[model samples]
Target: MIAERTEQADLLAGLRPDQWDAPTLCEGWRVREVVAHLTMPFRASLGRTMLDLAKARGDFNRMADTTARHDALQLSAADLLACMRQNIDHRWKPPGGGTHGALAHQVIHGLDVTVGLGLDRRVPPERVALVLTGMKPRNIKFFGTELDGLQLQATDVNWTHGTGTPVRGSAQDLLLFVCGRRLPPGRLSGTESP
Candidate 1:
């Protein structure tokens, strides 16, 4: 989590002011919104999070989306980055997932911003492998991917998953693909289009 946080902070720190408004792979969320979402767990209190979950009728997805959108409007890019840096060592854990969940959150969202911007921010293979190993079937489904008959092969790493129509790329790209991002062209190829 600390390494991912530092990598993300460095990447965001280098972005031009106008880039904050750029679109990310997270559908409606802009770059700033993604950053805001990244820092949400660090800034929001347990009571506030509970209230938010309640407001969404216990839908964690809605809570996260709405909170990210709402919080982005209240924070600047610099503030978002600062929050991330400040909480690099934070031990925020979800109900079922502990530190691994936090690491996955950081890595995946970090890719959402970087890949969405068409930037060349490659997450280290070690970190990507960690997240890959931690991915549960429910987690993949929650990310909106249907991997029933698909295979994932990482060209830049030894990791591979599933079997059937192969989707191949670098470990980072493969991670993003599994997480439901339509990667930029040429980043991935399959025996047939996925």
Candidate 2:
């Protein structure tokens, strides 16, 4: 979704100053905080990540939340968006994660804001595919839980994971599912929209 983010960032950059403080789906975080959080992960060196780990008590999500909370760039959403554009392609290694995992973070974070704001830009199909394919193994460690029991099958693409009853829909729907949105009544295991 790097390319899509480039396009998406352009849209975000143009948002009025007032919109930067808008609420996003990420609970208490505003759009500005989300942007700051996204920026904090780029090329985090061993030293910085270790500091984060200590701050998070070794939880990546906790670490990210902490960093975002403590980030100095809490003001000036325009500057944060500009930083996002500059760091859009920086390829964060996250101490021990793959580029695909970064792709997941990027797309999902994009959705957290876009979906919250009712924007129309979509994450690129290839980027989504890479994430869907990689989630099987990556999420085990990253999510600190089991996704094995969950069946994810995309309606708009040839995609499925796991083997039980399937939650199926367009790629975006599936992305929404993994991001923890409720499956639409008829979107799961069928072609009909809910």
Candidate 3:
């Protein structure tokens, strides 16, 4: 986990100021906004998250928009990177629970930035596995709406689980799907493809 954080920090370390304004794959989000959203996963308390969740109607976009607004106010790219460096080593979690919470935040949002930027950086296999394995429970319990009933199959790995029509693609593609990137529909195949 520490290594994953470090790797992400390294990834964010090199961005120039102009890069922050670049568009990302996350619909209308800019790269800097995504970085701000990624930088501070554990900064909020659970109560804050719950409040935000309620306001956002339990939508991830709500949570993201909450943080993005906060980031837009004061977070420069350098500040976001600094926050990652200061807090990355701390075992972090989402507002709700689990050690893997921070792991998911880092890896998934990392992809949001990297893939969104067209960086073509493949996520580390072990980190992806950590999220895939850990996220199954969370996906089922907390964010089950988006998943519906799609059996996700990763051609690049042994990931096969859940219920419904199967979607087969690269591990990264599946990762991006769950993380909410509209990766090439061509690279992905499954009943879950949306």
Candidate 4:
């Protein structure tokens, strides 16, 4: 998880200023908003997070969106990068989500920024495999991706999920798809690509 966070910080550090405003795979979030959301755990206290959640009427997604947008507007790209770099070793994890969830959060959001900017960054295969192995039904449901009759096959890795119309791509692309993200053209192929 530390390594993943460090890599993300490095990536952000190298981005051109204009790229900071680039759209990301995370819907409605530009690069700035995604970075703000990623660093929220490092900056927000548990009490403040709970207060924000209450303000959003207990909707986690609403709280996240509101916080990210506000933070993005308030913090510059350099500030967000500094926050990420300073907290690379932080062990914060989502409540009830453990270390694996922490890794997944970094990897997925990193992809959101990279893939959105059209950067060709490949997450390490082992890390992708670990996230794939740890996926649960609730995770899929949370993303609202309906895969009842669809199979996900990673052409670049020996991973397959479900059993029906095959959706083939790299493991990272498949991960994005499973997380309710739509990939750019040519990133995915098969009967039921997202």
Residue-level lDDT of model 4, residues 31-114, one tens digit each, is: 999999999999999999999999999999999999999999999999999999999999898887798888889999999999
Task: List lDDT for all candidates, in order.
Answer: 0.85, 0.69, 0.72, 0.91
Index of the highest-TM-score prediction:
4
Per-residue CA lDDT of candidate 3, range 7-108, in tens?
Answer: 878877887777678777666778777767765464666787778878888897777787786775677777777887887678766557477777776777
Over the stretch 1-194, how does candidate 1's per-residue lDDT look in tens digits? 77788878888889998889999988899998998888887899999999999999999989999999999999888898899888878888777878888888888888888888889878889889999988888888887777878788988778999988888888888888888787788888873323
Quick one: ranking by TM-score, best first? 4, 1, 2, 3
| Candidate achieving the largest lDDT | 4
TM-score of 4: 0.97
lDDT of 3 at 63: 76
Tell me the spans in candidate 3 whose CA falls farther than 4 Å from its real position: 41-64, 137-149, 163-165, 190-193
Q: What is the C-alpha RMSD of each candidate to the true structure, in Å?
A: 1.5, 3.7, 3.3, 1.0
Where is model 1 more than 4 Å wrong at Cα?
A: 191-194
Output the worst ten-in-a-row residue range by lDDT, candidate 3: 136-145
Who is ahead in TM-score, 3 or 4? 4
Judge candidate 1 at residue 45 and give its lDDT.
Answer: 90
After best superposition, candidate 3 residue 152: deviation in angstroms?
1.8
